[model samples]
Structures are given as structure tokens and as C-alpha cells.
Target chain A: GESVGLHLPTLSVQEGDNSIINCAYSNSASDYFIWYKQESGKGPQFIIDIRSNMDKRQGQRVTVLLNKTVKHLSLQIAATQPGDSAVYFCAENIKGNQGAQKLVFGQGTRLTINP
Target chain B: AAGVIQSPRHLIKEKRETATLKCYPIPRHDTVYWYQQGPGQDPQFLISFYEKMQSDKGSIPDRFSAQQFSDYHSELNMSSLELGDSALYFCASSPVLASTDTQYFGPGTRLTVL
Candidate 1:
């Protein structure tokens, strides 16, 4: 089965620096991607999303880049802050065997902000 | 803005026992999705409903069943639970169920099966 995965399991960034989280998908049929931030014991919070047709999309301080040729996706956070620490997951939208749309989430990258 | 609501933030169940999880979608939202995340694992899609109808199903065990009511609130019923069933179950809702619609998640219900 095609899966979504992360390139790293953990990441540490100094306060005020930038952080980048990477993810890859095995299914080329995936057409939509989203980044979510999960705090300890909390549900995932939507960060940003991009369609396969888009190469890049920008949010408040986040940017999502999509590379179709490599089946790679990245989320970049600018001026990282302490509150930015969390487990980040990248997900892809795919039609399941039953034709229902669902999200395939990555293994998750834990981001730590060092002050 | 109002977001998805899940009841009983924490639940403890014994093996072979049954558990029911409820989710209230954001007002006026018509689509609901359920996912399960084991410790240290990414969330796995369970099932979904659109307009009180089954829209999709994924990796859900036969012992598990779900339904979306007319109000768009949903419930997941798990029976004959095993110790391995302990995990965080999240419910997400979107105004619509589309390949590109953004789904907002609730606080999640943490189930601990002993």
C-alpha cells in the first residue's frame, strides 16, 4: 500500500530561526497535501495545504512546497517560536478502495524549539 | 469560530469490552471523518460520512461501526476491544467532503484499554 512518510523523526531549531519539515508520499495519484501540527495529547491543527496543481502556497508564516517529480512536500516555518514546538504531520488526499476520500498522514516529525 | 466537539476526553476500557465515541461536527458542516492514532504512530483513517450517508471506509475493523446522524454528529462504536485498541481517536469535520476541502479536527478522545 502506498504510504506517506517523513524524512526525519525529530528536528531542533533555535528560537527565531527557521524550521523545515519534509515528507514524501509513495502514491503518485495523490492530488492534495496538508500540514498539521499536533500538540501533546491534542488533535492535529491545520497549518497549510497545497493542491497537486500548485507548486507552493504561503500562509501567515508558513510555506508549503510541493515537488511532484520527487513526490516530496515540505513545510517551512519562519521565525520559529517556543509555541511552534509540536509534532508535525504531512498528509495526502487520496481516494480509498471504496472511492471515499481520506487523508494519508505521514509518520510525523517532532519539532523542538530551543530557547 | 465553533469547531468539532468530541465527548469523554478520556476513556478506559477492559479487554472484550465495548466503547462508544461521539463527535459533533461544526454547525452546518455536513461531512465527518474518524481517525485513530496509536502511540508514536501516525493517524490511520477509520471511516467517514457525508450528509448522513456513508462516504468512505478505511482500515476499520469489522468489530467497529459508525454512523452520521441527520444533525451531522457521528459516533464510533467499538466492540470486543483488545488491549491494542488503546489510542487517540480524532474526529474531523469539513463544510463539505471534497478531495480538497480542509478538515478541522476536535480535541480527540483518548482511549485506554487495559
Candidate 2:
């Protein structure tokens, strides 16, 4: 079965510095990728997403870069804040055996912000 | 502006017992999905309902079953719960008619099996 995975299990960064979370997917046919933020005791929240047709997409303070050749994806957060402290997960939208929307998620990267 | 709603903030059951979790999708949303998050792990897809039908099911065991009602409300039933069944369950909804991939999730239900 296809799976999505992250390189780092945890990342620590200064409050004012940038943070990068990396993810890799095994399915080359995946057409869409999304980043989600999960706070303690809460469900995953949609952050940003990019389609395979595009290489990069940007949100308010978040950017997603996708590399098709390497099946690597990254989420970059600018000026990391305390509120940004959470578990980050990347999911890939791929076709299912029954022809449905299937999202394969990575293990996740826990981001910790230092004062 | 109603969002996804899940019932039973927390639940505890003994081994071999059955547990049922519920979810109410945002009104008018055509798609509903269920996910499970084990301790120290990311959310994993369990099953999904769209257009009042079973759309997808992940690699979960057969003991896990789900149903979507005409009102767009969904329920996940886990029979013969085991210790490994302990996890956080989330419900989500999105517009199926649109190509948008944005999914809004509920607060989530924490299940603990003894």
C-alpha cells in the first residue's frame, strides 16, 4: 500500500526563526497534497494544500513546496510563533481501489517553539 | 455556520465490548470522513461517507463499521473493542461537489479501552 512519511519526528526552532517540515510520499499517482495542524487534544486543522499541477503554494504565512521527481513535500512556516507549536501532518490525495478520494497521511512532525 | 460535531468527548470500555462513536457533518456538506489517531501518531483514515453511501474504508479491521444517514450524520461502530482500540477519533466534512480538498474537522472523541 502507498504511504506518506515525514523525515523528522520533531523539530525545534526559535520563536522568530523559520521552520521547515519535510514529508515523502510513496504513490507517484497522487495528485493533491495538503498540510494539517493538530493542536493538543484537538482534531487536525487544514492549513494549506497544493495540487500536483503546481509546484508551490502559499498561504498567509505558510508555504508548501512539492517535488515530483523525489516524491518529497515540505511545509515552511515563517517567523515561527508559540501558537505554531503543534503536530504537523502531510496527506496525499490518491485514488482508491474503489475509485474514491483517498488521503494517505504521514506520521507527523511535532514542532516545538523555543522562547 | 455549523461545523462538524462529534458525540461523547470521551469513552471507556472493557475488552470485547462494543463502542459506538457518532458524528454530524456540517449541514449541506456532501462528504463525511472518520479518522483515528493513536498515541504519538498522526491521524489515519478509517472510513468515509459521501452521497449517503459508503465511499471508502482504510486498512482498519472488519470490527470497525460505519454508516451515514440521510441527514448526513455518520456513526462509527467498533465491536469487540480491544486495548489497541484506544485512540482519538475525528469526524470531518467537505464539499463533495467541488474540487476543493479542504476538510474541516470536529473536536474529536477520545476512546480508551481497558
Candidate 3:
């Protein structure tokens, strides 16, 4: 389950509903992780990030939960909106010696918000 | 500051042809990285450059190579391309060498192999 989670490639949710997207990482050594959103015909846009030292981090209407024991990462969006419809991806970083910019990514999950 | 920029926003090539993609890191940034994104998939690391040299390369084939110039710009070269090489290539830049350093990504170059 190392790959990014997208149980449903396209999730249809009524506007204002909460959204939860999951990701599984294989590298337990990954000390840092980030979530990115990519709209159609565009590159990924940075969202929020969480460090291994912490279990959860919250941003404006977004929360990232990290479970080290299960090697799971999840992004929870509160009050989903149409603009939230995009492909979301989670990336892991292992800072052994290669450095910080070398990140491994998981498969993207396409999220759709219904009107 | 302006974000990362990539050249040849779209490219089309035939099998056995060679393709070169260029990237310009963000202003004042020193680290550059290249990643490949297949349809409906996340971006995968291809290679990284720091201090104007190759620092790390993923499981990409030998035909796929990269070079850095003056520690600010980088190029990814694919020689003898195959149909399977078609994918959206992205360039990312980060300021320092810290694990928590945030990475900024370029729009990406869509490569189509015919």
C-alpha cells in the first residue's frame, strides 16, 4: 500500500460534505510527507504537509493525519466544494543522505465534488 | 518569486527519436529535480541535481539522462525514445538542502510518443 490512495478514482460528494482521501507509504524511514492537488491540464499544487514527529497537522479546512504504525496518511477536507475537485497525491521524503528534494510519490486520487 | 519554468510545453516524437526537455529553477533556488507522471498516476522521481551535478537518479533507464548548468537550470534528455516513454515530465525546485524544504513545481512538459 505504498502507493497513494484513491479507493475511488472519482469521488462524487454533495457540496458541503466532508471528504477523506487516504494514502499508504512503504518507506517507514520517510520523515516528511506532503499532499498536492493537480487540476486538469495543470501541474500539482502544494497543499499541506506533516512530519513524522507529529501525528496530525491542520490547515484551513484541511487536516492531514499520519499513522506511523499502520504506515498510513490521510487528507481530510471539510465542507468540500466544487473547486476541490482535482487529483490529489501524497509524496514521501527519506532524508538519509540523498537530501530533501528527492521525493517519492504515490498514485493520485481523483476527487470530484458534486453540486 | 516566479515559479519554475519548463520549455517545450508540448512535444511529439516518433520512436527512435530523441527529445530534450529544459527546466529553469526558481530564482535563488539551488536544487532541481525531474519527475515523470503517467496518465492518472502521481509524479515519479526520475533524477535530481544539486551543486550543478547529478545527485540521485531513480530506476529510469540509461537512455534517460539529465545535466545541470550553473546550478540553476537543468535538462532531461531521452535518447532513442520508445512509445512507452510518453508521459508528462515535471521539474521541481527547492531553496536549500533541508529535508523539510518545500518544493515548487513547474507546469510540466507533455511528451507524446508516436
Candidates in descending lDDT order:
1, 2, 3
Q: Per-residue lDDT of B8-103 in model 3, one digit per residue for the tens? A: 999999999999999999999888889998887778888888878777777678999899898589999999999988999999998877788878
* Model 3, runs deviating above 4 Å: A1-8
* lDDT score at residue B90, model 3, on the 0-100 scale: 94
> Candidate 2 — which residues are off by over 4 angstroms?
B97-100
Q: Give TM-scores for every candidate, taking all chains together and pairing residue i with residue i.
A: 0.97, 0.95, 0.93
Per-candidate Cα lDDT values, in order, are 0.94, 0.89, 0.86
DockQ of predicted candidate 2? 0.59
Task: DockQ for every model, please.
Answer: 0.70, 0.59, 0.68
Residue B13 miss distance in model 1 (angstroms): 1.1
Off by over 4 Å in 1: A97-99
The interface root mean square deviation of candidate 1 comes to 1.7
Residue pairs of candidate 1 with colliding backbone atoms: none
lDDT tens readout by residue for model 1, B37-94? 9999999999999989989888899999999998889999999999999999999998
A1-115 per-residue lDDT for model 3 (tens digits): 2344445566777899999988888877778999999998787889999999999999999999999999899999999989999988888875635664577777778888989
lDDT of 2 by residue, A1-115 (tens): 6889999999999998999999999989888899999999998888999999999999988999999999999999999999999999999876654566756789999999999
Q: Is the docking of candidate 1 incorrect, acceptable, medium or high quality?
A: medium
Interface RMSD of 3: 1.9
Instruction: Give per-residue lDDT, candidate 2, residue B58.
Output: 84
Q: Which ten residues in a row have the lowest lDDT in candidate 1 chain B?
A: B94-103
